[model samples]
Target: MEYFELNDGNKMPAVGFGTYKLTDPEETPNTVDAAISAGYRLIDTARVYTNEALVGKGIKQNGIPRDQLFVTSKVWISDNGYDKTKQAIDSSLEKLQLDYLDLYLIHQPYGDNYGSWRAMEEAQAAGKIKSLGVSNFPDYQITDLAQFNKVKPAINQIEINPWNQEKATVDYLKSYGIQPEAWAPFAQGYDHIFTNPTLSQIAESHGKGVGQVMLRWLFQRGIVSIAKSAKPARIKENVDVFDFNLSDDEMKQISELDRKEGVSADHTDPKTVLRLSKYTTNLNGLD
Candidate 1:
C-alpha cells in the first residue's frame, strides 16, 4: 500500500478504511474484522461513529498488534475547546481501547475550533496523539487555523469523490503542507455517480468495478482516500485498488464526471453544522 507523508513527518496509508455510518451496532465489529483481515491497517473512526469500542473489539479479536494498526478518531463540535478536546481525546482513546492514537481530528469547523486546536496541539506534545488535524474545514478555515496554531494539522479530512471534486480546496490545503484525505470517495453511490456509464466503461475495459475505478482516480490524484463497505465482498473490492492504474485519458474522463454536488452533510451549511451538533451518539447509536 502507498503512504502519504504528513507535514509533521508521519506516514499514513494513502488508502484506508472509513467507518462512518458503518458504526451500526450489529455490523461494525465483523465489518472491522473483515477490513483488517483484508489487510487494511488504517481505520478511521470518530466519537460520533460510536463503534470505537467495537473497532477495539475487532482489533483484539483479530489479534492484530496495536502498533501494526493506524487508528484515527475525532472530537465533536460540542466537545470543542482545550479542556473539552483534551477530555474528548482521552474519551476517544479509552473507547478505542488504545494507548495512543495514530491521528485525531476536530470533527467540524464550528465550535471553539481554535481553542480545540490548542488542545490537539498540546495532546500531540503530551504524547496522547501521534498526529492532529481538522475535518470538514474550508480553505479559509485551513489558513486561519494554520496561522494561529503552533502545531498545524497534519491532515485535513474532507469530502472528496468523482462528483464532488475538491481540487481547489485540495490545492489550497496542500499549499499549507497539509495532506488531503478524502472521506466519501465514492459520493455514497448518489445519482449512480460511481456506476456512471463512462466510469463503468472504463472499469469494464480494465476488468474492475466502477467503485474501484473511482478509487484509482483518487489515488492517482494523490489524495488519501478512506472508503467504507459493510459487506465483505465489497470490503475486499474497495481495497483491491492497487493492481491497476487508470490511463491519463481515463482519469480525465472520470474527472469530467464531476457535478460538484456533495452526498453527505455539507460542512459549509450552517444548518448542517447545527444538526450535527444537536445529535449526541452513544455506544448503541455509534456501535
Candidate 2:
C-alpha cells in the first residue's frame, strides 16, 4: 500500500480500515483481527465508535509488532479543553490498550478546541502520540486554530467520494500542508455510482470491480481513505488496491463526477451540528 508523507515528515498509509457505524463490541475485535491478518497496517477508530478496546485486542492477538501497526483514534467534543483533552487521551489509551497512538484526532471543530489543540500538542511532545490532527474541521476552523497552536495538524479526515469530491476544500487543505483523508468514500452506497456508465466502463477497461475502481481513484488523488466492512472476505478485498492504477482520462472523468457540496450532514446548519453533538454524550452505551 502507498503512504502519504506528513508535514512532520512521517509516512502514513494511504489506505486504512475504518470502523464507523460499527457499534457491536464483539464484532469489532474479530473484524479488526481479520483486517490485520489480511495485510492492513492502518486501523482507524474513534471514541465515538466505542470499539477501541476491541480494536486493540485484535492487534494484540495478531502478534504484529506495535511499531508495524498504525492505530488512529479521535477525541470527542465532550472531552474538549486542555485538561479534559489530556484526560481523554489517557482514556483513549485505556480503551485501545496501547502505549501511544500513531495518530490522535480532535473529533470535531466544536467545543473548546483551542484548549483541545493545546492538549494534543502536549500529548505529542510527551510521546503519548506520534502525530495529531482533526476530523470534520473546515478551512476557517483550521485558520482560526492555527493562530494559537505551534503544531500544525498532520491530517484532516473529511468526507470525500466520487460524488462529493470537494476539490475546493481539498485545495484549501493542501495549502496548509495538511493531508486530506476520506471517511465515507463510497457515499454509504447511497447512489448509482456502483453501476454508473462511466465508472462501469472504467472498471471493465481495467478488469477491476467497481469498488476497486473507486478505491483506485481515491488513492491516485493522494488522499488517505478509510474503507470499512464487517465481512472478513470483504475486509481483505478492500486493501488489494495497490495492483491497479487509474489512467489520466479515467481519473479526470471521474473527478468531474463531483457533486460540489455534499457533506454527510448539513454541517452549516446549527440543528445538524446540535444533532451530531448528541453523539458526543454517553450515547447511553448504545453506540
- Give every collision pair in model 2: none
Give lDDT tens digits, candidate 2, residues 121-170: 99899999998889888888877776568998888898899889989888
| Global lDDT of each candidate | 0.84, 0.84
Tens digit per residue, CA lDDT, model 1, 170-193: 888878799999988888778877
TM-score of 2: 0.95
Per-candidate TM equals 0.95, 0.95
- Which ranges of candidate 2 are over 4 A from the true structure? 284-287
Error of 1 at 137 (Å): 0.2
| Worst 10-residue lDDT window, candidate 2 | 278-287
